[model samples]
Each structure stands twice: as C-alpha cells, then as structure tokens.
Target: MNVTLRTPRFILRQPQVGDAEPIARFLNDFAVSGNLARVPFPYHLSDAKAWLRTRVPGLPVENSNFAIELPGEGLAGHVGFHPGPQGPVLGYWLGQPFWNRGIMTEAVIASLDWFFSASQAPAVYSGVFHFNAASLAIQTKLGFTQTGRSTLLCLARGAEVEHIDTIMTRSVWKARPK
Candidate 1:
C-alpha cells in the first residue's frame, strides 16, 4: 500500500529506518508513556526498532501506517488504522512538545479521509483510556461518537480500567464537511 497524506502543517508518510530514534524519544516522554496504553516507560531504541520492524508494516491491514511530520520538522507524531472485524481501529500519538497545537487533530482528520477513500471499511473506531481527554476531544471533533465502553487490563500500566470506544460510520463520514 502506497499511502502518503498531507495536512496544512503535517505530512503523513510511511516510516523509515531513521525514525527509530525520534520515536523512541517520543515514547519515553512521561506525558506519552503515562497516557498511552502500549508504550512502555523508559522506552528503548531497541524497542522502537522492534515496533517499526514488526508493527509498522502491519498497519492499515486495509490501508497503511503513517509517520506524522511537521513541515521542516522531523516526525512529530503517528496516526493510523488497523483492520478490525467490523472496520478499522484508529490510533495516534503526538510528541508531548507538540501537544495543544492542533497538529494531531489535523493528522487524524486527514487519516480518516484516507481510510474511507481507500478501504471498504464502513466505519472507523478508537478506544481511549478514560483519562485521555485530549484524545477524546480530537475524535469528537472529527465526528466520532461514543459507541460503548469496556474494561480491559493494561499490562503496560499494570491495571484494569474502563475505556471509551468511539466510532464514526461511513454514512456519518460522508456527511462531514469537505
């Protein structure tokens, strides 16, 4: 899958070998490490390498994984979809330094557009930890609605918690402003 998406301030492209160090740094940030479900604290270069080598390629079983970059800056975030039984699950994370700048929101909106255009997915969904208000806000801004909730054990967090699952269907997507 050849996937490259652009927003006004960011470019969403495929991950390259060089992205490992930056990604590792992003993952190690306390703000990110504490909020995200799978990212480990004290994230390592080797961990980043393994993730890029294994997980990055499997992204968007129907579409692709994208490295989110600000123009002139290197990678600032990541946003993508993974195939699901119903449709696709959206996921994203921005470097802490870039938070509150609307960059992630822009990247996510562009990714959803690409997903709907490239795949047969009738809907896209994402699960946000209860405390991730920023992420919840971003999804809501993109027209995703709270569909349900579930409790899952987060091994990385070493706890069981409730998470809100949000979804946006094709019908709703088609009605969104261009």
Candidate 2:
C-alpha cells in the first residue's frame, strides 16, 4: 500500500514508530476517548505501539488505515476503510483539537477518490451513531445517501445501538464536480 496521501493541509499516512508517542497522547484525551468506541481511556504508548505494529500490518488489500498528520501541528487523527461483503466501510476520527476544521471531510474525499481509482468496489458505506451529527453531515456532503438503519451490538460501548447507514456509489461520485 502507498504510505501517504497528501491533501491541502494534511498528510494521511501509514502509522510509523515515530507516531507512537503522539498517538498515545491523543487517544488518552478525554474528549477523544469518550466519542470513540475502540480507544481506551488513559491509552498508553504500549497500546499505540501494539496498534501500529500488530494490528495495522494485517489489514487486507481492500482495507486501508491512515494516520492523519498536520505537519508542524502534530497528529490529528485517523481514517480508514474496511472492505465488507457489500462494499467498503468507512471510518474516521479527529482529535478534539482538530474538530470543526473540515480536515476529516477532506481526508474522506481523498480516500474515496483513491478507492474508486484503485479498487473494483462500486460503493462505499458509512455508519454513524444516531447522535453523531457531525459525521452524518460529512457523509452527506460527500454525496452519500441514507440507505438504511441498523441496530448493532457495540461490545466496546456495551450497548445495542442504532446507526444510520449511508452509501455512496461510484456512479454518484463520478457525476459530482471534481
């Protein structure tokens, strides 16, 4: 996989050894910890290293995980796609300090472009918790349409939750203004 994706103000790259300390710090922030289901509160450098070294290397061909970094500003967050039976599943998160800055949306657009160009997949899907309005808005802005709702058992959150599933197809994406 390519190591990096450059956007106007961000670099979406694979996680490296140098990223461990900053990622650990961001993961432990209360604001970031509360919103994400997988990241533990009080996250440690060991956890970051484990995530980068073990989990990241095993991602499949259809999937990609990127560490969002703003040079001179530090690690901003992460974004990725998980290939599913139906299509690719998109996921992303931004550090609290980077919120409301449109960074994630830009990253998503770039990822979508890469997916369409590189893969055979025809569509991309994203699921946002009902209360995550910012995420919903981002997907909508990227031209995804609400396809359905799903009730998922989130073991990490310890709840049966409702999520709005949105989808964007290659046809739709290709028709959009570039």
Candidate 3:
C-alpha cells in the first residue's frame, strides 16, 4: 500500500521496484546477514526480487514492510511487522554505515505506536540473536520482556542458533515511562 510514515529523520515508506539493487548491496555484507534469519550470504539480485514480490503495497500494516529512507542516503535500512503465532513480530536491520545512531529505535517506536494504536492485538513479539546486543537493547527499551529462548535457523550462518524471544503487552506499551 502507498503507506508513507515519517519520523523526524527518515521516511518509512513502501519498497519500490528499484530497491532490489541497493537491497542486495547492503544485505550482501556478512555483518548485516549474520544477525538475520532469512537473508543468505552473497545475496543476489534474485533474492531481492523474491523479497519484493512478497511485499504487496496494499497489505495491512501488520503484514507490510517499509524501507527506512533518509533524504540523502535513500534506503538506509528496513523494518516491518510479520504475523507471529501469538501476535505480530517486529524485525529490522540497518546497514553497517548507519549503525549506532538510534535510528532503528526511532523507526521501531514510530511503527509500533502505529501498530499498537491501530490494531486490537494483545501484544507484540520479537526475537534477538544471542550476539545481537543492540537489537536486544532496542526491544527492551521498547518494553518487551523476555518470554523464552529457542534455536532458529539462520540462512546466513546456515544453522539454528540461540535466539532470545520477548513480548510486550498493550498495557506495557501504554505504561512505558516517558
């Protein structure tokens, strides 16, 4: 769908036809793919094409994806919610060049505010790989509490690895300390 969400710095908008090349460029990096479950190493143009094909523009918010775009850098990252067994699951990544700036956190906050405010779901779930301290911190900062752990397949690493699962209820979101 033609959804265009904005944070103070970036535009969370639809992934267009031309994003595949840049998507392949940034995602081909080992650092970017290592923490992800589905992105394969040496990512190809076809891989990007497959992902874009799945993301229909008009899909509802809970089932959609967005390119994290800056005015100058264009597609700097990606973020989105996918359906989970219990509720919606949050996922995101920023290219290595854009790391450590709190940009992903802002994107997550804005998207979830829209998700939580717009939907009637009870809560949201997220899982962070064991070594991804940054992602764990982001989820915690957003009030997601640890639910458990599991070994999930990693397309990049080509194996199942330890993942920390977390959940955040509507009440928790509403009561988050400002």
Winner by TM-score = 3
Off by over 4 Å in 2: 40-42, 55-59
Better of 1 and 3 by lDDT: 3
Candidate with the larger lDDT of 2 and 3: 3
Give the residue spans of candidate 3 off by over 4 A.
Answer: none
Model 2 lDDT at residue 73: 94
Q: Per-residue lDDT for 65 in model 3?
A: 80
Number of clashing pairs per prediction, in order: 0, 0, 2
Candidate 2: worst 10 consecutive residues by lDDT?
151-160
How much is 170 displaced in model 1, in angstroms? Answer: 1.1
| Candidate 2 per-residue lDDT over residues 20-59, each given as its tens digit | 8988888778666555545666788998898778545656
Write down the TM-score of every candidate. Answer: 0.91, 0.87, 0.95
Clashing pairs in 1: none
lDDT-based ranking, best first? 3, 1, 2
Error of 3 at 69 (Å): 0.4
Leading candidate by lDDT: 3
Per-residue CA lDDT of model 3 for 32-104, tens digit only, reads 9999987899889899999999987568767878899988888888988888777788889888999999999
Candidate 3 clashing pairs, residues 3+ apart or interchain: 1-57, 1-58
Q: What's the CA error at residue 152 for candidate 2, in Å?
A: 2.6
